[model samples]
Target: MFRVLGALTGTGGPAKLDQEEQSEKILSQAHDFEVALQAMDYVLDDHPGKGLQLLEGSGAKPKNEEDQCVRVLARGVIEFLEATLGFEASVMKKAAATLSEAQQLSAKRRQQFQKMGLKTSSLYPPGTEYAVTFAEACLLHALLMLFSESMVESAKALFKLRKAYHMLREILNDINAAKKKKGSAMYAQGNNESFASFVSADSSTFKSVDIPYSLSTEEQQNKELMELAENVYNMRKKRLEGAHIGNSPAIERLRTDLGIQALKDLPKKKEAKKPVTLSKAEIDKDQATIDEFIHSGVNLCFGILQVVLSLIPPAIGAVLSVVGFHGSREEGLRLVWRSTKDRNIHGGIGLLGLLFYYDGPFQFTDVDFDVPATSDGLKKTSSNDLDNSTLLHPGKMLEDALLQARALFPNSALWLLQEARMLSSRGRLQEAVDLMDSIDVSGIEMKQVRALMIFDRAMTLVHLHEFERAAEDLLSLLDINEWSHALYTYFAGCCYLENYRMCQMGLMEYSRIDFFKERATTLIFDAPNMLSRKKFMSKNLPLDRFMLRKVEQFKKFQSQLQLQDPLDAIGVSPVHELTYFYNGYNRMTEDCLKLSHKLLTEYHNPTIDAKEPNQELVKNLLTSLTSRRLGKVQEGCDMLDKNVLPQIITLQPDGKVKYIKKTEDPWAYPTALYERALFTWKLKGLDGLEECKMWLTRAQDYADDYELSARIGMKIKAAIDRLEG
Candidate 1:
């Protein structure tokens, strides 16, 4: 009878059949649901309405707590994506509801896990961690999506974002604890007596299996688990700590659109529940991680609020240093440094935030340089000094962080791109190009990454004065990605036009000009962004207001070049006479002057030499122009005579290089002479024409075969015809 009873129970084999069945059911349901949701993503790409079909059937229904959480999270994610893409308002409302449900479900599920002793210990079951982690990640990602989709900065949005922040912090704590335990266990096993005894007893085993090189199944599983945890940490870190416009910019913009105190009166934590207690060991182990997490979170939150506060009405960016967000440059740098020093994690984003803090907003074309004269003289300052006081060097810090990030994530193209950017910023053009070239783009499946690398390389090439190479790179980028069609087309045009200028100066072959010109003409006028009907900014192609102006510049430049074809073909003169010559010239003059002023104010370091030859050249050119315009012909002539161009080497058509004689720039000396001659002819009529003629002759000599000569020649002949006829 006892034997029969043992057989009925099967000892331990069939005794826990119910529990095994339950676990298997839960796992199967959750896995199937997740896989179905992933498949639905591709379907939703083309047929977004198909998502509603998923919610209609038991195919996506939850069989257990984990499945329930996954169902809620996936539904929320799908709806949010649809809503962001301009889906129905009803869908957006449903998305909000789903996300709220997911958040509550996640919290309740955590409570259930705690009750089951899953989080504190591993007593519940084998799949407990997966359920808990998946539910938690789902909650965090949903909140992130909610915040991303939210158009207004309501008290609710801030609360959700803050909650997500705390949740991520907790997740990171658990991951760190697991990592510590794994590390300790690995260390102990490696140094254990059994391992040492085995190695000593079997020399052949030692030869066959190197102790460190060979990993048991369990050890490999642990290694994979740790890697997965690290990846989770990085994912959460990016969303929470990234500088995406969604993260802080949207919140800030919401404040601006609403008001500064729009969400200020809201409760700090939306949830009023008390926090769970942990052991002293747990607290001690996670203290550093907690501190770092909170530090970064606060900076991110209030830093955004402060920026918004300072942006209203009069630009109060200066007041931020005084009374705004308590986060200083020092604190921000410290946060980035902490992340950057850690291994197998991301801090490149934090570094970017620090850069934005220091470098200020990207102004596209609004570069302003102002210098005020003091009692002693003009006080010297620079844009570098604008933000470098509290930091050793932001550039060096960025480089160090990028290096650490690359070491940690060797396959991450982002780190490589950032390192390349840092190199380009520091004027290491060739090194930047080489670094970008070293990236194996063939294996990179993300077209955006490939496009970015190519674009960055092209920009670096531009700096290196390799216009043809730069244009080629831009073409390659456009072929792969049309993120900012206008932006790329404009850049390509700029490259080609720059090469055309070099060709005009005999530095490049005339045949090269036609190739580049064809490219520029095809791309410049019909730049895509200029005609973009899309409503939203492209994730891959970011464009600013200044880009519109750049397009205009390209148009004006191309039009001017077209007008010069007759003169260019005949080799009669360098300067082409256009009907609207003065308009283009004046407009370009203002633009050039603005650029010069910015360079002088922001980039010039007076302390280096106290006397800049380039600055002197600009001053001389300005003085000559001013005197000529003010009817002081003699003074203008004197100024023009004193100035000369920087020595330049010209590459001749015969493949030989020659040093040209020091002379004035065509725009400077020839223009000065022409202006003076015109004024003289105006004052004294035909008798004054002799001095005018002489000046014209001198201008012609200086202009030689350059484009400037044509304009001067046209004016001289017109005046001479009036005087003689």
Candidate 2:
């Protein structure tokens, strides 16, 4: 660390200078590329929705690495520079015209791609961060190549320009030395005549790279090994240069050679050598498995210790502490950090510490602990503090707990389940699942225990918006054969939402919907009081309002789901979830109006009051409803279209809108589609009207429901009728 740090700070040896300069050349090339790309990006930005949109005709094809590099390297940098440079009116006009045309052109890509029935987002590997990197790297290569040749070639001219260029060259010298010392692959492969590049703006790239090695044939190995070695050497060389570390010939040579002199030193086994060979992937998996066991053991042990220490005798705890049974002061601190994780280690550690020390004692007893039934072992967690210096470290804490618990109960699922919950809370979802998978919940209603785990996991999935998985888990839980209206209703509502989304996304399955809805209704009607007596506030906030709204929505949707032939027909309702939402909206409005009306007389309209806040939105929706009730559908709709919709887009579910009031827009959320449909109905050349179905599809980005589908379907029918007439 010191050597690397010193070299970086200019205290490195002269030999390191060459490697450092080479790295500097690379870095300089990257900067130049940035400046250049920034310019192009500015041009692109000026024309917002424009550019290389020719999709079906031809995808973006930067034939070689250089072209790809330059394209990406010169992206946002120049654009940002231009933003600072005062854009003129003419420039703005030109940009607008260009972007307008670009947008029009770009639509074709989406159109053709959609017709083929594939996800555009999935065209690139989901969440891959490749495109930006490779492009920049390519550009860096080109820029450095250009600069290096230019510097060595233009060394004389640069000497005349100023001392700044010389200083830059010297800095590059130092950087190059460091890169060579470390043995960069890029540097080894990089021609002294050329520079470097790789700048891409696209989030992902799927370019295939040659695997670099094949031990299948000795002949193939001989040929590929050299290339692979070169690649490795180049990367090492560049890494050293970038860090400004002093160049070391020995290091470079060492990188080039094997432990022994001859090729015999290299392992003879191929990837799957029957006797001993292991692939990198296999090795990684083995290591991970080992780590999992260690983590699990440590956690369980710590949990046992925490419980045991809590019950320790004061004198013994103090004597043990002084005698270093736990660890030295530093060791203790470090162990505390490792132990604070969800080790399910609670009860005794801090209490023991407090008992031992008369002075201010450790506050382990103050730490929050939960004893829960789960698939993983028990978990005792620390709050959000990352240091783990607190009682939350799971390592020792969990280790202690397991030790103590096993002594008392031998083997208990109840304790292990708590462990699983702890793992889930710490973002170790898969780990928690694995831990649960190892459990045997037999004889003691293990199915229900497993079901609970499924529920917890489903909750997490829901948070991540993995609705499909969450729905599946929830359904599994319902299938367990469960009871209670509130529980089943909630699951039913969630299931319906999932199905609605699936249906909207071109899914034609009806049986799935029927099954979920049936389950939901059965659970919902099991107890009438389930809907009324439940307290909505989950964690302090009176969520009763929101929960009620959700329940009301589902109930309404269920009521509207009157099938013509319950036994023979498809049970999927056209607007089940939507019916619920609309129903919920009505219920919430009813409550809101009551509050608003009371305020209208006493508080003279809505004012800022935390306790009894304003209900302007409710009042407005009421007014709209009144107008609609008084035979003003068209008028109310217009008011909703022009006024309410935009505001609702920003309205909080629980918090009322401060500036806007009311629900004049009966079809507020679907206004975008409604207008598009209406425009088509009027024979107006609405923007993207031909792609109305696509617009509807985009609307289902978050979730789906029968209400929206019905509205859209109705609009389509109305437009068809008007067009035919």
Candidate 3:
């Protein structure tokens, strides 16, 4: 345990000058990879073209096996980012290919190291030849990348995913075995001297030297990687198990196959086996280390556990009714409190997790989990109030973690950023802003971490409705963040529009607006309040000049306070517009269909907009209604039959149109039938009346238990009466 844990603290042997130079070279390569990762994040998050250029320019040819492994990983990540941002199948294919290369490279490295009889029990520094664990991480990451991007319906993808899971299970088992081995007296005693000797030896000489040691201390990173893997799986699983998408057959088959394969893969031994048992003391020590690792904030386990609990829902009582654990609020809170007791990374992370959990009020019921009806009988538990005397509040936890953890990781921007996030998550936006303002970023060395902190601050400001201030931050961020320029520019435009809205509503005082202007000047180290410039709104910014016409139109509407729907404001992104339309349609607002039509006609830029949550069906329905209002009876009938009615018609493999069940096409089926009934009444001859009644009857038949169906039925009856008269 000491061997494994000490590796995490960077305690290793002094290297020769030549070895140190090699280490330096490896560090430089690793640093390049890390920088590329950060740039990828920005590009994926913000969609800036410059980020892609930075990523492309940063690529360097590999000179060694280690460098080659890093190169593969970098290529995989870059391709993954491209696939995500572009949503292009070609990009996804490229990602799949790059990641496959990475996996092969990683596997080759692992085999090479294993053949050389490299000890896995002792701890090694990052740049050492013994750090084959990084290759394992690369392979795991590649597999996950493919799994995430690949279609679940594809049998080949499912097979690959199953293999990935199998690999992950094997890796974890090995790490656990290594942990157990290092814990034993034989491996633990006198291992430090062996490790020092192993590290000091030249790479060529070290492989041939038979070091008497257990596989060195790679267990800490193994545990961390396992946590990451679990977290990624759980997050993706949660999405699949959503009400709108439940119980994927592909995933289920993969899980079952993996389980069966695991059983089959176990070795059969003919020799008599002795049952070995541990003493109570030994058992306690093992449990202590496991517990410490589980709760360690350095890993993603805490986040994973929180997400798993959220998915379980409060009604379930215990998460899958597992032994020794309940899914109640008390159990969740208790788990959080246990981790918070630590003065290191875990404490800070636990506090942050607690804030999100507790911010939902008495119980953590914010996330919409697809909880089963059978869970109603389970015992309920309520979270303690924020002001409860016994419970530790989020505010106190953040304050403590900052003061306590500082002694260890004093220059950590993560801690400060998390603190700010906690405050923002709890709606203490001003306080969060002030805390961030106090952070002296000059002391932070990592440029990526510093940029991330600033980005977080900018987002927090946006949440606080300080759009002008947020815009300034975004503009500054855009200057440095080439990857996310488009995203930042888009947000900057949003901020301008929002600030304009505030001005129209008299929400922004002149002094506050002036204060924002002063901050913008100060960002470039200029004289504060010296430049009497134009008020920085979306319309005035020189950025994204192509959007000038749209901004100008929005400003005209803003001055007259004529933009009835903020969503309808011209300068707003199409993404926001779609969200507005979706919300309005769900609520069955009077102008929703018309609003959607206006958006579809005006600002639906195919080049820039994401193709999802399509509103064309709603627009067609509106057109059908409009034709009926204009007394174009035949046109209305034809529109309903052709455009509006087909939504509920699922085609069979044989090309026959099949009527979907109410459960399958919930909103579409009943609504389409009702529309069909209305349009049939407008058709020529008395047979039209009979056809109208038949369609209305079908609508009623499918919608018997639905409340909205009753309203549709009443309207259908009224139309039938008018036709019969």
Candidate 4:
């Protein structure tokens, strides 16, 4: 009995360790677990430095595999946070290295368990928890690899993702198998154990089962998983074999058939007949923690992967299907929702993921407007209603989750940020700004979160037409982080330009007009030069690329019109023009829309050149979009058809329109098509679905290399999907 308890406790022998030492070891393990949890709590509460310090202060050497895994994972998470927030290559490299070390630790632990003759298929296998850790480390490492400037690294990341995916699937299979075998003798014995025995059992009375040790024959299975991973990797490699960098999609899909083949080809290994088993008390005590941790971790990692992969544009999604990978957004959301029900670190992250999706990407792509229900039982056409009816509405779920998170971590500013985002989405911009301002991020160690809060507030301020304040907030980001200096500079410049225009129209104080104009000119010209200084994966960020294009066009317009003042060449407020990418029009208040329309119409480059049709097209596009948001669907449609479309298309003798492509304003034609589609949908509802799809399809063709083309593509795909649904 003494031998069994000692073995279970990893002491090797009762004679080698005294009773006091045994108790101290168990207590120390518990303490380490608590410390890890506390560290995570600090991070979620926005005190990342405290979190890191707490983790590092807790003994540098881990006492056990679990402790080692927890410490490495916690530290790696901090590194990941810093890397993603700062977008620094060096930080990402460090994160990858830390996660790689975790993977190695997990592998070593797995080998130790295998040598102990533990069956991989057994419920709550001694070291199966390491598999969960391994998968998680692999997934995180793969994600960090994506930040690399090398395509080879990206390709390697894809292979790593496949391996992690399969590893997770295997763990899920083990869990399902355990559920099926719950009534077996081994399982029943573990279940029948008393909690009291677990806490108070005398080491002398415990007995070790005499199980024969044998080598595991799982090498073939590992090879099979690797082969499956290789197949998907090769498919992507073939597709991108000769493509220029950044030309082809970085990731290709794994075919569904290949996925099915993987499952079929990798048959489950036979379970060991004489598996070593811990006593019932020990099993019951440890199983609860193990189950919770493993289950939540799997759900969190797999759920995020699904959600991210599912976000691929349908055009890209279809192409991805040809190669092999597919993700269901609905299933992904469901899994993430499940993970949020736990109290673990996974649950906290799951909550953040849901909030970000509901407030950020979901808002950006979903274009449904609110429609009042009719007494006659007419169908409502709002996208929000559609999502609600389909059980995809996260409103109530998110509210409940936020409540739980706030209750658990009362000091967390992250939740407050999410709440503010909710307010902003509901058109309560000032309240959102106020809520954001109330959070004192001045002392927060995570500069990324601080930057995010500041950026969010600035954007909300822009929506409120507080241009001067918004400019100040944007410029302030430069001091906090170096993620994107060009983006900050360009946006600050646009804000100043907006302020100058407001002053010109007497909407703002006229005394600072010259100061605003001069600052705007200097910042705008300086923005293009800053681009070469910052890059992501060796390419200009999408927003930076868009800014560069806009600056070039602005200069060309100035040259053509022979304008001396750079401000005079601006036909539309560049800030307002860029807001389209953010789906800002959808969130605009009626009065704000009116103000925007007025400003867009009021600004004119005095000398109109017939040769430069882009300036007029830009004005019309902004006006038409604002008009649509203002509930003038037909008016918006007419503006696009009569005013904007005519300038970009020529009626051929065969009665087919040939697009008159302009290199300068390539974005105008496609964006106009997309706007026209939305207007059609609003006016015609279900009747106009086909027409909306046609227009959306045409928009895709015209979007090549256009500014914010990726964003436009996502909107186009989302609209088409909604129309089809």
Candidate 2 regions off by >4 Å?
A: 1-410, 426-431, 440-454, 460-485, 507-546, 553-725
* Backbone clash count, each prediction separately: 4, 122, 15, 8
Candidates' lDDT values, in order?
A: 0.40, 0.31, 0.40, 0.63
**lDDT computed for candidate 3:** 0.40
Number of the candidate with higher TM-score, 1 or 4: 4
The count of residue-pair clashes in candidate 3 stands at: 15
Error of 4 at 436 (Å): 1.6
Candidate 2: Cα lDDT at 458 = 57
Q: Among all windows of ten consecutive residues in candidate 2, which has the lowest summed lDDT? A: 120-129
Model 2, span 353-382: residue lDDT tens = 222221111112211111122313323234
Model 1 misplaced stretches (Cα beyond 4 Å): 1-329, 344-398, 528-530, 533-725
Model 4 segments beyond 4 Å from truth? 1-34, 58-60, 64-67, 114-127, 144-158, 183-191, 194-287, 314-323, 361-391, 607-611, 645-663, 666-670, 701-707, 721-725
> Please, what is the TM-score per model?
0.41, 0.24, 0.38, 0.76
Q: lDDT by residue for model 1 over 566-615, one digit each (tens)?
A: 21221101111110122111212333334322322233222212333433
